[model samples]
Target: MNTLLLHCRPGFEGEVCAELSELAANLGVAGYAKGKAGGAHAEFVCSETGGAERLMQGARFNQLIFPRQWARGDYLALPETDRISVLLQALADYPQCGSLWLEVFDTNEGKELSNFCKKFEAPLRKALEKAGRLVEDPSKPRLLLTFKSGREVFLGIAETSNSALWPMGIPRLKFPREAPSRSTLKLEEAWHTFIPREQWDTRLSEDMTGVDLGAAPGGWTYQLVRRGMLVTAIDNGPMAQSLMDTGLVTHLMVDGFTWKPKQPVDWMVCDIVEKPARTAAMVEEWISGGHCREAVVNLKLPMKQRYAEVRKLLQRLDEAFKAERLRVSIACKQLYHDREEVTCHLRRL
Candidate 1:
């Protein structure tokens, strides 16, 4: 309980730490360690007895940190042969061979690391087979590349190798504590675990009416129309013909912030380029007025004050809903496709 390992989508390390800091303020963290796993993954360390629970409650946690995942560390400075022996031994000891993820990390100064990896593939694969674990590729084991400056080499391992470790399985929440979706731009087979079709169905309405606030290219709108929902796309730009061809989205050449549905829609989605507060207010208006039962929006954060902006936005949204005597379940996250903003989904509680 003294230490807990946290993981996040790469490039979001600073935001994750900022989020952890806020959560820790309430639950308290003794200290932390941060690093990267190639370009796609990052890790943080905190105490389980410290602010782990609060971190779990943060907007980043639902989207970044997997709650039930366990990570253990093994640091060794052994020779090439010993390193191979140790890893093979660890794999043999592991109850589930498929769950073993052997990543070799060394500092930039370690010129022999690549050669070490080249030399150990045979032994590792043989040991894996002897342990009743199948190595998908005996010759080319996927080794994550990274650089760290320290005496000891640390090999981090995950016990639960579920879809959560897949490239596309991570949920980048739209808003903090709201519904999550895989990146439409980077959409691929790898994302099947990121958001199962079942979860997507729950968030959709078979007969729901809604609007896509920034539906230009129609990524979000495509999802809505496929669910048999009619959408009024409120954008100043042209939408994709395929989206328009769905014959479900009505293109509106009007400002998203100023436009209103003829009547209350069942849902409202926004991916507008606007301030976080402005976007939050729009959502607040729709949710508070019962104009929409559910919403998915993205807030563009300032280069600085990213965490502060996130905190402030959350506070404002909560207060606005409370004032209207309304309850909402919200999720906010830094999506894989997202750069400087977070995606959010708000549903009436």
Candidate 2:
């Protein structure tokens, strides 16, 4: 009854478990995390009564790196004959929810259950309303029912403010047909994830200037151009002629690692395929050395211990900035559009 369920990208379940186990232990909530590799989900079972509450109270969702989303509640194994009754009974003692989201894992089997979830939603809502367990108040918590299979489900709850904006932590972003490459979506997703939408007008204005490293085919550069920023795109390879036609980009054939802007720019972006540590160090230089006021860089991860590598890199950045007495804010996430890498956003405060 004291389990915390976490949803993550498939194949990173071990990393998620490692992260949550460490986090829970650090917060003095004795627990253990369990999940098979590639399960796409994990669970942390607390050792004592109300441990889940304490764990949730101490942990900040945004600070967690491995898990895409999480919820804390009691687990319920439903009867085959009347599954709806089992759900209602399990929720009897819980508070009313402003909304309900029926979720499944991010696996092939989970996708197969999508139709079931959609069909079950209406009846579930009707039952909740009839039983006084559902409300329309945004201030209330949202009920999250995560189904692992037709007969197994985890009944959990999360505050809307503390959870992901969309179900399953997936944002509904579309690829622009005009963009030169599919990689453009990665940068677009990074913006939506890292920068608050309301602050975009001021922080990402068209009047700013930017530098895009490894800008071949002009994927990341296109995003900057679309935002109306003047871009200096550096790469040894060719860029899309259509992007060049915009008259907003200056292409320079040079090494991304060695190339530097003559003066400080508004933003510095890189999507080069290289060791993640190297990319992280480059980003640190750009931010701490005052080359750019802000940056969004991608770190190509190793196959093993990806989360550990990310933590180490972030720690390295923090220590480097602290030693220089620089005021900076940093955030990182494994974006949905990203594979074998994670995106980071750094801004000088």
Candidate 3:
């Protein structure tokens, strides 16, 4: 069994570790060991050959900690250039390797580390270049360099890996590359953790209907329509012409709190830039009254307690639903595109 190291985004080590653990459990990865690197990175070792591939295939695997890896295969003394050359040769033979990155880790305290990094770069770069693939910028290359000590160094290369991440409750979602103008933004759809449409089952209700609070731009409404559901968009602002053209979107120019569907709908989706508590309260009321069968809401967070606030909100939702004698499934995730808030998804039991 090959040793696999999994790395995650900076500052999201804990969440990433949770993600990885979940992956391991679901994928049957064995011999796992996890830790952090000064709070900026999370690292875990697994013994599955396809572990890295599984991690990358999932949408959750955003950036590479070290995309590819090669074992040093030796320990004793050797010249820096010779060591790098030997590692580079192994990298060239590594079937999964693409472009290579260069960095030398100084685990040997007080050693001449910078010198090693500089000397190692030239030959490594040359070796990769001779193989017909040029090394791009060192700062953000597909390859990653890391070391535990003089006795061990890890070299990683970039390649595609597959993991059926969605079956494990991870949403498959991505962000838009360009921001839209105000008028166009209304038509834009923003789903935090949208499962692929094909994955939604009858148990989740395809006949679901939705109410989009602050729907002036109709971005959230589009998400409902795409699911083959009706949406009552509530806001005083103008909705994009495209949404109105869809006919599935209904524009209601009224205050969200004052506006309620004549009958309960399947869901309520909100994107109002308001206090988190207010948003939480609104959701609580709707669920308590049985106004909607499910909901997806956004909570705008303060600069601090961003993570803590979301945690508390979920706890409250659980308690609120319990008091009403209802069972609910809820998920909160900080989307790759989210800045100051998180998206919350809820389904009634």
What do the candidate models score in CA lDDT, each in turn?
Answer: 0.56, 0.89, 0.56
Pairs of residues clashing in candidate 3: 53-161, 53-162, 68-156, 68-157, 69-156, 186-217
Instruction: State candidate 2's TM-score.
Output: 0.96
TM-score of predicted structure 3: 0.54
Model 1 misplaced regions, further than 4 Å: 1-11, 33-60, 63-84, 88-98, 101-183, 186-199
Ordered list by lDDT, greatest first: 2, 1, 3
Worst 10 residues of 1 by lDDT: 141-150
Q: Which stretches of candidate 2 lie over 4 Å from their true place?
A: none
Give lDDT for model 2: 0.89
Q: Looking at model 2, report the run of 10 residues with the lowest lDDT sum.
A: 59-68
Q: Which model, 1 or 2, shows the larger TM-score?
A: 2
lDDT of 3 by residue, 111-212 (tens): 345465556667766766777545454332255444444445555544322211221112334433221223122222223234444546552344777888
Backbone clashes (count) for model 2:
0
Sorted by TM-score (best first), the order is 2, 1, 3
The reply for model 3, stretches above 4 Å from the true place, is 1-198, 201-207
